[model samples]
Target: MLIRNKALFNKGLMLMGSFLCVFVSLFLPIWGGHGNGLDAADNMFNRLSKGSSYFIPGVKEDALKLEGKSVTITVKVKDAELAPRAVENLVKAGATAEFKDGAITYSGDLGKVLGAALIDADDLFNNRGPAVLERYAATEKNAEKTIVKAWWAVLDPSIKELQKQKLIQEAKVVGQVNKRGLEPGYNFYGINSEKVLDNVLPLVGLLAFYVLYTMWYGYAIFDMFAGIGLGMSKPKTKSEA
Candidate 1:
């Protein structure tokens, strides 16, 4: 009955449009926004349980495989120097890890492996990963600067945390920026999400639409109800006489 009238129908349509925007946003290709990293963080355990090795990229002879509640993760470092630390990290992750023949292998509870992988991924985004990855990726003259720059670019969306790590002197980052042929341009994560559509927009948009729809139709509905009440209160017409 409420939607029978034109005004009420239009209000209902606007309310539905708002919900449509929210529904579409969920599957939209938003790279970074709050949806990518923070939402992932919130559902980390559930995501892990579903068995996606999101943090680790590529397939080594040893890849992190999840089966039931078990997990196996392998980390390969370009520098043998990083091997010890890699194993140590896995240990901290509650995995039985061993570093031998240039790679570290971790096997244990999926939760622990995933937790460690997430920590390492965050560490990478925070500059620790990029700084180290570029060293292996760079070989050409002045290529180190650009390669690292690209990695840093991917990590740039999370720059606030990178600044706090202090493990690599800020001076080095500055020096790399000044190096010749440095053109940072990789966005591995959802870096463009905020400009187009943000995760928070859905909830906020839904609320705004509901409020606006009420503003458009609230009085109209009340008026209809009031009219009905008044009709009942007054004498009824005798068969349309």
Candidate 2:
């Protein structure tokens, strides 16, 4: 290529080399030598995400509004073996649960039953797997038969049954409890929890690096293009006739 602007070409090369240096450093444990920059950022976000996913408290308020409301619903479990465990969960939650005709029929206060579910979800969310396991009298040997999954099996059918009975508000509240409360607990289980305030410095540093890195790339491209005489130029103004 012809040497259009040696100064701009050198500047571009310098910026690219510096960018590569930072890129390579990202793979090293530059963040306190405990983990690479990328890992640190990933862990920080995971923790922050878990911290923000605490919706059980709000769901509890809505669910408890269903206090003294009795609901009789039969929920089917796809896995026959797990039906009994789901029964145990509801029964433990102050509900009468019986497994018959290939389904578990529950009868009890709606609020109390949902309250028990929220407690289990809270335990799982806090990484207290033993608490949930103990609640269901289960072991993790099968992994699939965990208490959380059993909650899902029961909650799914319960929601449908509620909707069928035209208890729309009850159905919505139960669905919200399952989705916002239990789902987050299950999804974010085992992730570290952190407040944004506690991680302000690192969060700020990561965000700043992102902005600078993006701009660094843009500047590199702009300089390289300008050096090669490929830069955009302003169009000549048209003379008024």
Candidate 3:
């Protein structure tokens, strides 16, 4: 085939090189929230996403000794509409969730569950106006009033302190990383189809180079073959006869 049609064969080789360039460009990895300078935050998200359970030196033993059994931390929010959403959020963040008695039952590590429940419940009310959230926080609606179920009391202050310090966004991303209703492109650490598109641009550049090189090399070879054919077809000189 090469002898019969050198030009066509060279063009075919150039076209094939373009595919290689596109393949690599689209799949190149880029930094993401999972490990892109967010490992601690990401780990927190994973832990909370599984369940807020954690090991304290003595809390588990104390709960066994004092409470007479394993205790399930729970809370009730005032808004019925937001209550169900908060329950769903808790479940996604890795805790057991049930809606009962106008409340959310989240059985997990107290601090972790406490943080998620409080932050998320209020997140539902965030749009009503800052004044409304301010009233909720000021009144301590985030805590269970009874001391016996006060497993979450400590986190109440800590969360407020963070809010006081204006670390609200960082404070919540731990659980928010795995929440529903995220922005369309908020893919945590997973590579989305959009990222694959970025790779396409790189591949296009590589394929361009490949195509250009193939065209030059193919033309050179084809031109050389054509010259040989022309010489062979010429009539014999009189001197040789």
Candidate 4:
């Protein structure tokens, strides 16, 4: 190929080579405590995400309104071993629970039952899995799955029964606790918490790098094209009458 602009060509080569170097560095284990650049960025975002998803406090407010509301429901436990643990959790929450035939018939004030769930969800959200296990008399093996899963099994049906009893607000509170509390807690269990303010610098840096890197590639291509005599030019207008 004929060399049209040697300086532009060399600049492109330099930019592209440097860009490639940075790209390869992303996979290297350089970020302390969080593996590579990719992993570190993902970890940072996960922590920030978990930090932002704390909705337990609002749900608790909703539950407080239903403090004296009463509910009675029998939820069948698919896992027989978890049945007793589920009953224990209910009883500990100031509910009367009878475990028979792999189903737990529980009765209590609506607020206390939901409050207990919120406590468990908060613990799990804060990465306190052992606290939940201990609360439910559960062992470490499959601890989170066994305990959290049991809570879900019981609460899910209780919400349905509450709806059947026309306790709409009460049911909504439990649903919110499950969605905003338990799910996030379970999903983001092991991630370290990071506030957005604490990570403002790095977060902004990553976003800025993303924008610059995209432009970096575009300019590299443009420079290379210009060096090869492929630059666009404004068309000359015909001399008028």
Candidate 5:
């Protein structure tokens, strides 16, 4: 009887040990890794989005919010000759252009007149090619400035159109006018800690349940074996004993 009890106790212990090993090896690590990975991803995206907004400045606002206001146009011209012509054209149409460093700026009320002026400038650049552009360069170094100038030249018309349609008011053109690009950042719409936790909590719960179930299964199996051993070790009967 004593021997049988000892055997039963050992079997129970073995079952429990097996359950713990399986539970820890399979479910616990997976649960941990999954939760951590999700957290890291959310954090990364949040940082990227915030950084973009900070660096780009004013990108968070609607594009059409600037409609009907006075604006300043800045450009970098490589060709000195084209610069004069560009400035002359702008001045003739009641828009002012000034050159400082290597850039030209046209500042005025962004009304229909300015818009029409931009359109005419666009046509001149598009149709005349390099020949018309060559006349504007003051030095050989300015030759390379054509592309950027042409780009600004083209954008003028679009800005004017936007003004006419009341899409954007009071515009400021900075950087290379022709080289328009998005500011750096991420623009995720609806991500928050609560949302992230909601998605992850279920996996964690499942893992806990699995661990508990494994432990219980081990105990149950041990109990069954112990009961069987106890029954077998009982004396047969009075006569036999």
Candidate 6:
């Protein structure tokens, strides 16, 4: 009885261990969150259809590729009072800021600009330090927002137009050229289908592991039941009888 009980306990432990391993494997990747794949894809598509506003001359085309592009955009603004406001606008516009060496460097997307605006407004009332610094900071913050907004607004409209043009071209090519047996030309840009698939691989892998874990647990349960059945099936030898 002691030995059988020990064996049962061991089996239970083995089952628990297997279950834990499977659970950890399935959830570990999910805990890391869905990476910036979707964002990167959007940016890539935007860049492909409409040129990037931030793209500088001499920057390698390959560098612009979404495979390893950084989502952060950094801008420097001078003024201590402006720094806080600038940071605020940056945050509103979906950005972050750091004050360094008399300059506030803001990094983010369109949302960051809104955040900077908010910061600038707040500083107007709260800033009480060096008047010179405060005045300059306020001016700098406003200037930065105006410049950024103008550039982005201009680029935004152009991008929309470019997308429209691309769509029309694609439709014409597909409907007329392809039908006529000429090679169909489609503009390839941004994140391709393969990349999207790759992005989902982590999620898929997690689900696959979950399925595997279920199978393993089911087998373990069956094995335990089989052991119990075998123990019951053994004929009892009654020596005293």
- Best prediction by TM-score: 2
Task: Name the 10 consecutive residues with the lowest summed lDDT in model 5.
Answer: 181-190
- In candidate 6, how many Å is residue 221 off? 1.2
* Shift of residue 42 alpha carbon in model 6, Å: 20
Q: Can you write out model 5's per-residue Cα lDDT over 1-241, one digit (the tens) per residue?
A: 2345665676776777776675566543353535443454445456444333332223213222332555566666555556665665556546777767866787655453334333333333233324334544434543323433543453444455445545443333422122222211112222221333444565466568668876688575756567456443556676764
The lDDT values for all models are: 0.41, 0.85, 0.39, 0.82, 0.46, 0.39
TM-score of each: 0.25, 0.80, 0.21, 0.78, 0.26, 0.23
- lDDT tens digits, residue span 1-241, model 4: 9869999988887888888999999999987875998998888899999889989888888877878888888877767787876777788889999988767899999788888878888888888888888777677686865556667768877777778888887888888877887788778887788899998999999999999999998888888889999888998999999
- How high a TM-score does candidate 3 get? 0.21
All predictions: root-mean-square deviation over Cα? 17.3, 3.4, 18.8, 3.6, 18.7, 18.7
> Mind giving the per-residue lDDT tens digits that candidate 2 earns over 1-241?
8869989988988998899998999899877638998887888899998888898999999988999999999878888877877888888888999999998988999999889888888888888877777766676573423667678778877888999999999999989988988888787788878899998997898899899999998898889889988888998999999
Q: Model 3, residue 76: displacement in angstroms?
A: 1.9
CA RMSD (A), model 3: 18.8
lDDT of 3 by residue, 119-174 (tens): 33323322222333343343445221211112132223333444555656433432
The predicted structure with the larger lDDT, 1 or 2, is 2
Candidate 4, residue 108: the lDDT equals 93
Give the local distance difference test score of model 5: 0.46
- List where candidate 3 sits over 4 angstroms from the true fold: 1-71, 111-241
Question: Of 4 and 5, which scores higher on lDDT?
Answer: 4
The numbered model that scores best in lDDT is: 2
Candidate 4 regions exceeding 4 Å error are 1-3, 72-108, 153-161, 239-241
| Candidate ranking (TM-score, best to worst) | 2, 4, 5, 1, 6, 3
- The candidates, ranked best first by lDDT, are 2, 4, 5, 1, 3, 6
Q: Which is the better candidate, 3 or 5, if ranked by lDDT?
A: 5
